[model samples]
Target: MVLYKNEPLTGHPCSRPMARECVATLPASYFSDPKVFNLELQAIWSREWIYACHENRLRMTSPLEMTLATFPISLCLSESGSVAGSLNALTGKPDSRRIHTHVLNGFVFVNFSDAPPPFESTHVGLADEFKSVEHVFTEAEFDFWGHLSLPGAFNWKVFSDNYNECYHCPTSHPQFSKVYKIPSYVVDAREGYFVHSVEERQEGGKAAAASNASVTELLLTESNESFPMEAKRLYDESYSALNQKIKEYAKANPPRARAKAHEGGLFVHVFPNVGINVFGDFVTTLRWNPASHEKTLLQLEVFVRKGVSEAEMLRFSNFLKWVEIEDYVLCEATQKNLALGVYQVGVLHPFRENGLVHSQAQIRKRLVEYVSQERELKEKVGKQRDSSTTLSEESGTLLN
Candidate 1:
């Protein structure tokens, strides 16, 4: 439920002092109010690291179009490999702001704030961590496929909530639950990013293979070979080449970071709106691009180690598409309810919904700071007005 008007936000849900209490979800207005959404765009989204396009999208002669809080931006590379950004809204005008850029493992991340926290400090160890698992996506071993963009009728946070935790997966996504061992799921929450992972059930690979075969057979039957096979075949060949390269590298080297023998999957959620899912066979990305208070664009990208079969590739794509559909349906319904004003707020399950608590708390915290800044600005203006009035009065007296 929403907090009482007189109640103080003196404690955080993550803190021991407030851990036992029925912590309230963020207010309905945070997800439903246009004014609140605009403030979030200015405060949170503008300052956080946003997943821009992959590095391969840019070229020395061409620029990749981007947006920050709906303001158009562009990123281009020069012949010497230097990257530059053009903020269209401030283009050709006297400006002190420059977009910040960080390229990690070929994924381009941008921040719009004049001074975002230093990339290395805010994202400490992540670059090295991802690099440790670079076999799956190192430029020499993997190639970028195409991307999928789907529009949904819901606040971006709705889908984010769905993705953050999988307590609902067993009931909502049976197939996904079958492959992902929900009980072994662990979360490592950090200052700027969160890593939530699940051990892959031993039986999952076989089950997933069966599912893929069925999907592929059905698709082939339905299309009667009309499905675009040429492009898929090309991808398969590229994957095969990648597989050989991986084998050679593995023979020459061992895993840099050794862990107990476990076939687990890992996913990292970067603050604000990007998720990276690393599975056994492929790496997938989900980016939530805010369209409005009630709309978000879901961008999905799948990358596989170079040597995957055509049927398997198709299967993975189909599976992801199905997953996206399921998520969007629930997110849209949740958004409708959130907008109905029928519920003010609800309580979050301390252990299961900790991600929601942290994320919403971050949102509320930034908003409160913005409000404080606004109040201070107003007070300064008021003082200036009084000071000017006093100066004019003294001048009149002296003249008289």
Candidate 2:
């Protein structure tokens, strides 16, 4: 059970468990090695349920399968009435760089996103008039898994790992803490989800402390009587009150962003390589596939872009984009520094980082399974060769 690779890195724990830390200690060469990464790519990704299309992606045709690079995909909904997609890894063919196409029954189908105008499901329609989904071949996703960053992202694991905890808000994310208060750290993953989990830590230990401190403050309130009323006074909050000047000072620094309803719903990573952000209007289905061990391909689709008011769309886009940027910068920073000669792999804040630990545990388990199977195959092959050699020697002896 090699939990933390022997290396060193620098990054504050994104969650509580104050002493817990992470050092991008996973070796850089591992990412450079195709073999190590491919193992993770195949066993963990292919066998898992990646985020395909969000619930609202298709008013017409829903996605059936989504694959990581080229494997059994569920991103394309291939229900009888829905469109089906296929990709074959051809080596010597004319268009051999991984072909992705749609077909119904045995006939090639058209992609609606690429249709010039009047886009409709192609059944018995003319092939000549249809244009290929050009993005399929040249999209940034092709490079998503091989580089440190992309046109639209830096590293995705930040989003996955960050969504797993909210422990840093009180200090690191002053802007964010104002709006949301978190207490619990473990991710109460959605039911039936095998890979990812969403954690909410609202109303934490600080709340209790606040309640206890209020008794003394209340007496001071009656005697000192000359109290200056402020926006978030000691007892201003609904349930608790605070006694210290430090807590008051901390609150004053940044007026917490007023929280609206959970219009921007929670996001969930579908293990291995897909993410889903369930917001107010619609959820987003984001796919990240390994372009290489260190890089990944990302796809973003808004499942419910329709029926949204312009205002809500703008707000959603702004918040989502900003949050992603914040996460990307951190993930990349960790990825880059992880290869340094001095960083050590650290533990997840078990309470807050359960999802991250779960993900790591899952990856480790799969690695063990796949490596074991490979070893078995090599042993079998070696035994066959030895048996064949013995048979040949026996034949020579018999003939002689």
Candidate 3:
């Protein structure tokens, strides 16, 4: 009689120790409490390096005016062609206060703090990683395709919590799951950011071959009559013109080899509100703009290679929109539940939800420090008040 031995199942290395521990998520108050949100605005959003825009958007003639975490900022190009930032006062004048600005691989970042932490030290590994792929960001290699703004009626943290983990991708994003392998997805927490790695689904030894062939066939065989009229009306250029541009671009510049990576796609979420999604043929950035404690505007900026077709771009955009809508529904529903005043805290799955755990830890650390300082100040003020009262009583007794 031959007996077979049972084999042990192994998971991703980063999740092994986390699987052994049960962690608690942040309290519901963190999501719905106005006081906590205000604290965060001072602690996290105002202090950290917030992604502003790509360098391509900055003009020599005029400065780009925008708001970061409700603080007005004007990004201008100096004589040396480097970016400079200025804080805008309530009266629409440029304040004397300095706004720290840093550009990494064509992506611009700004900090509202007076003395922000050193960008290199804060970013550490992330800056080095961006430098490695700096070639792809050059004007000769890729172009800024466009950007999309998606407004949501949920707290910014809710949206961030959703972005930090892929545990819900299988259930929440079916189309996205079909494109990437879910079980192999991993999110690694770095110094000041989180790295998400996922491999594309393969068929017959080729990455994304199935999806690519289907999309190519759809683009070739489909007639213009079936094109969505709404899309045509929304976009300034016609399908034919876009297709011609794609062909011309392809002829001018042949497709080059992409940067090497163990996984097919890599996504980096910097502290606060920046997400960089890096793929072979294209890249997209996700920026979260907090309009209020309960409202967030998500901006997606797409950059594509020289030869990517219009149909391919449209398909990718539609897929992203579908995923965004699904996440928006989830975040808004979660926010409503949080505001119900019933669920105070929840447990997290150590193995599948470690990314969320890391994000909450970062937030909790900042809020905890703020709370500590606030208590200390209150105690000091109370002591001073009591001393003054005692002194007044003694003075009255002496006068009597």
Top candidate when judged by lDDT against the true structure: 3
TM-score to true structure, per model = 0.76, 0.52, 0.76
CA lDDT of every candidate: 0.64, 0.39, 0.68
What is residue 390's positional error in candidate 2, in angstroms?
28
For lDDT, candidate 2 versus 3, the one ahead is 3
Q: Please state the error at residue 238 of candidate 1 in Å.
A: 23
A best-first ranking of the candidates according to their lDDT comes to: 3, 1, 2
Per-residue lDDT tens digits for candidate 1, residues 1-400, read 2232232223322121113445788777678877667777766788777887666657423577755457688888778866667666566777534588888777778888888888778776567657756654465544455565666789888888788777777777766787778877655555666677677677775556534253432232234433235423433343344344434543444333223222234578877888987765667778998988898888766665555555555566656644555576678778989988998988886556656766777777876776566556657767554554432332332122
For the record, the alpha-carbon RMSD of candidate 2 to the native fold, in angstroms, is 18.9
Write model 3 residue lDDT over 144-248, tens digit each, in one string. 666666666789999998998898999888878887788988777666777777777764223442133434312312336322444333232323344354445
Runs in model 3 deviating more than 4 A are 1-20, 59-62, 91-96, 132-139, 204-265, 375-400
Greater-TM-score candidate between 2 and 3: 3
lDDT string for model 2 (1-400, tens) is 3234232211312221222344222234343445555555545544443333432233234444444444534334444434344333445544312223443211222221222222122112222211222211212111111101133222344444555566654544543454455453235332212222224335532233222122221232234433333211322231122113223433443223323332334444545555544443344555665555556555555433222332333333334433444444455555666545355545555445545655555555666675666546657767654554432332332122
Score candidate 3 by TM-score against the native: 0.76
